[model samples]
Target chain A: MEQHLVDCDLCFDALQVLQQQQYREKYQPLSASMQQYIRNSIKQVSHAHKAERYQRQEQKKESFLIYFWVVAAIAAGAGLIYLIQQQDKFKPSVTKAMASNAEIPAQRVEAPAVQAAVVTPVRAERADTLSHRPAPPAATTTAPVAPPAATPAPATPKPVIKDSVKAKTPAAVPVNKDSAKKQAPPATKPAEVKETVKAPAPEHKDTPTVAKKTEDKPEPKPVPKEKKDDDDDKPKPKPATETAASGTDEFLYKAAMVYHQQGDLNEAISRYKHLSGSSGKYGELSRYQLAVCYRSKGQTGKARRMFKEVVRMNGSMKDKAQAALDNL
Target chain B: MLQQLSNLSDKELISRARKLKDQEAEGVLMERYSHLMVAVCLPYLNNGPATSPEEIYPALLQRLSDSLKTQTIPKANEWIHYTIRAQQARTDKNSPFFPSTESREQQQIEARIEKAATNQKEQQQLIATIERTLDKLSAEEKYLLKEFYMNNKSFAALAETKQISIEKLRQTLQQAKQKMASLLMNETYE
Candidate 1:
């Protein structure tokens, strides 16, 4: 129909003009009642539009409030996550301190000694032996003699511990021992230190609270004896050398991590190598991490070698190897 | 007729024709709408009708007036018809003029119109074409068309209410006049 009308624009325009002219001749044929009925409908439609507009405006306001609440909920969730993460970071440190404080309840003889054990490695060995003895020492003496033997690295143990303790001298040993012997229950001393650290039991009213300085200056004895025993077995080897040669990745990895945490990169790197060269899950991780340790210690050459070896070995840890190589 | 349609509401247009003798709005509405309305009607109008317009036009206009009386003319876009026989029945069934027969024929016509625009694209195109051509006017012109064709207002009354001279009102309506001309002409190109 449109195609037929396209013959000429002028012809179409003329036809339109004629149609309009014809239309004007006779347009209105409506009576009065029809006009009134239509007027009422128009009023109804106008009123409906106004009501609809108000409803839509209310919906818009409700949606805006919903949007605001959703954003607030998200912000609250994020803040909660941050708070939890911050608490997690500090939680371990606080627990460690609290653990020391709550150590004594029934007979706290074990706790001060355990705390001293952590602070002074020299006294730790003595505390361990004394903790196992039939009775607690009446005075705190000869505490240093115990740590070297218990640790098996007797010579190195004393000097390092003494250096740490020099800043805070343990009380005179015999005087401390005299107070402790009077205070401690002779029967319960053997049961005090368990293989797994015991929970501090509830306080007993019968127990004496003696604040005799327990971490005594260690007695110097037979340091040369333990070193000589290690030397006699392998004349030139140190106790660390022996442990390193054991190739137990779990133990070595742990020792390396401890050293790493203590900021001893050279020692950590050496221990990490001992573990990395062995086979295990820890061994694979240790090899990758050892390279990182070497890099941290500024031994790039050694780091590159370790990283290359890790990539050459096929395992689930290959991705880790690749990442280390990329770092190199 | 188009000017009257522009002034009158659909209800008034139908109502005015209802009381008339020969039912004049049918020819005037069709003549004014001959180009566009025939296109709308063509799909609903049967080719079989030679003398059918006699029964058909009056019946269709009367039905349209009946639909207006019942406020159903707005949906005439959906209720297009081929023969006035169904409309005659529709009018008779609810007629102040004459009682009608039950219309199976109107249902059939409605079904056929539905079938003609089966493909979604075709249906969409039909609706789109109608909307675009009708929407060529500004909001005011569209409102005027709604008043005149659908509401049945008079030109003299509209001119008086708008507080304008008839000549000024005609001039103001020229934009819509030109658009309707182009729509009738089918020349939107330039």
Candidate 2:
């Protein structure tokens, strides 16, 4: 029939007209009532779907909040546990200090005897040196008097004694004595009193052991001043060695960092200053922290100066120091 | 809700209908394609006799409701093909061109050729012959011819329903037309 329509012009024209008429009839829009019915049905379906979607979203939100609260509670519980553990670790040292304080008086009585035993050999050597001199007993008698006088005198003599003793004695003994004097002032004072009996030995015999004993006597007399000088001299090259040996500098540095993190600027500043004065591993870091402390405390001039010094050193703190300087 | 439904596309409305069984989404889908449904019904209704709009409209609606219930309708263009096929099948069953008494073995021979007559008589016979030839086609083939030649639906829509490319749909359409031509010439399509 298609071939027949293509061969015959009249049949082709009739088919085209029929098809066009069919197209026109088919394209006619539906009646208004049918359209209204469809619109109403669509409105119902859309409402149902929307309600279902909204319910699902609400359920999801509720589940998310529940999980968030659960996670937050777990994190808070872990933090509390950690804090408790830290407190337990630190409490024993405080209890030990309190226990030691309670036993101090008993220790004081026995302390003098221990000092006598420790000082006897040095004193006997001094006595032997006095046997060689004519006026050595006079020197021994004057030694106790000299100490009382020196106790009232200025800090200048402490350095002279330290330098002479350090020059004459074995290097290790003076360092040990200096550290001992630094560590326990009360115990060292009685020990120094016993050693004062041996102070005349160095003058008589010129022996290094007696010299060291003589140095130990005057050490407690000008304790505060001698400590300052010893701190200044000991930290220069031996700060790393000393901190490595004892771990006190590292502990103090950690404490300082904790204070800084805790926003205790004043305490952090004090700790950083002490650590900065020492040439330990933390020295450069402490200097940087000290600058940060000063800057936080609103002492911009001191902060800037410290930052400049750190920048000049060009150590680990150089970049931070440069940034701090720029911020200032 | 109606405003929201109005904002959604035809594909979205159908998806909602399928997934959520949303009555409003089905209603929206019906509204979107009702014109095409009415158009496809007109060809079947107007082909033989002058059927009343009242009679045709209810029957069309009934067929659409049945198809929607079955959920067998494809996309808009392909869906129109299904509706046309359904209309043609109903029309043929109600008014068959060939009598059921004619055995398949007897009908296998070519249809009798009529003598050439007056121009009006010849045109009427051509129309009858075309209708007879269309009835010989399977429902699927009738739907393809109606959508392709009559409605001129986009090849893209046909391809999507067929799950093939537009070029493939065009090639298939060409082959279908050749087979249709052979059937019209009283030759076996196979």
Candidate 3:
């Protein structure tokens, strides 16, 4: 019928006549309603499929986020555990090394040793040297010039100048000539004693402290001057090595200072290095000046190390070294 | 989406409906055959308690829908006609729809004809094969086919010329076409 209808005008005309019949009107609306109903059913099925797909995608995303957080938490917990273990490993070394020096919590042997440890290495060494030195026979005589400290040989470490048992040199000397007359015979010391006393005064900034002492103790002049004479006589009574060590330390310090002033950093660094081992004022001073020279020469790493050493030395330049280190 | 689905052939729509469980493709296929179904069932409407147009059409649609899911339908017209006739007789038989070999052959030949429309050489080849197939048929079948196709005679006109009913004429024309398709396919396979 289709093959015939394609070439036949009569069949096409008959199809049009059949389409014009009332049966089309009867089924057309029904067919349209059926199509709409079917479309609605299809839309419902498609919507359900889309909802299922969306729900699956959301579940996958949620699971992925859960995995990510779990991994992150595991990494963080592992890192924290490592840090704690590292801290635990270091704790015993600290407690053992500081055991004798610092007081143990259970038995705090004494805190004076801890204080001695905490004190600057220079001041602590000075205190040890002073305490180890023999008590001069003129200690009681020098009481008027001495500070008010009364501690024994193994005393708790004080500051750099806790010399109550020793005499104040400048305080004992009269600054003007007239007051110098009344104390002449008693204050007269050997030329060697006087020269030894006066030889090391102008090295660094310690000379001003001497003048400050005289100004501070102008009233107790006569007794302290006798005490000063006793202190001068101490050099002659000392071992030869003591004076010789002091002389070398002073000479090395002066040579370093000369090179330092002349901008010869390499030579100065070498000289300072030599002097820095000797535990005295020059040792502390050389270390501090070495750090300063390093800073000037732009060897920042070496400079930082030297400054840290000075700060650890707890010398007069500790504050300056700490500030420079903080800036660096 | 409906416009694009409407553009698909009956075979494509059947494939989508069966494999993808696409209701819209099924709907397009049903709507494509709705007029034919209505025309076939028009005489049987209100003939019995179950034969109302509304009842018969819905029931026919339901049977076609159920069969569409499970059956391999090569020819939708034959499947829909079987479903409509089954509904009209109130047979209550649950037999699944299957395409006859003749229908499959006819469908194959129709597909080949459609494919060859673009290539003139292939189109001439197909035409020659069909003519050769036509010449090999019995005289009565061959005469019915030539009158219906080459003469462009309507089924009513041919039935009137033979002094037979239009239904018988249509049946004879159907048999002749099937014979031609079977002959063409048998030759192709050989």
Measured by lDDT, the strongest candidate is 3
For model 3, what TM-score is found for chain B?
0.82
Q: What is the TM-score of chain A alone in each candidate?
A: 0.30, 0.36, 0.28
lDDT of 2 at A284: 72
Worst 10 residues of 1 chain B by lDDT: B96-105
Tell me the tens digit of each residue's lDDT in model 3 across A242-320. 5565665665676677678889898788777755655667777887888888889998888888788778767788898
Global CA lDDT computed for model 2: 0.55
Ranking by lDDT: 3, 2, 1
Q: Using DockQ as the measure, which candidate wins?
A: 2
Candidate 2 has which clashing residue pairs, if any?
A26-B39, A41-B24, A42-B24, A45-B24
Please tell me which model should have the higher DockQ, number 2 or number 3: 2
lDDT of 1 by residue, B18-99 (tens): 5542133433433333333222222233446432433444455445545544443322222332223355234345433221
Off by over 4 Å in 2: A1-30, A45-66, A69-328, B1-9, B19-23, B35-74, B80-190
How far is B117's C-alpha from truth in model 3 (Å)?
Answer: 4.2
For model 3 the local lDDT of residue B103 reads 70
Shift of residue A131 alpha carbon in model 2, Å = 19
**How many residue pairs clash in each candidate at the backbone level?**
32, 4, 0
Tens digits of per-residue lDDT for model 2, A174-220: 54354344442332332454334333322222222232332323343
Q: What is candidate 3's CA lDDT for residue A307?
A: 84
DockQ of 1: 0.02
The whole-model C-alpha lDDT of candidate 1 against the native structure comes to 0.46
What is each predicted model's overall lDDT from 0 to 1?
0.46, 0.55, 0.63
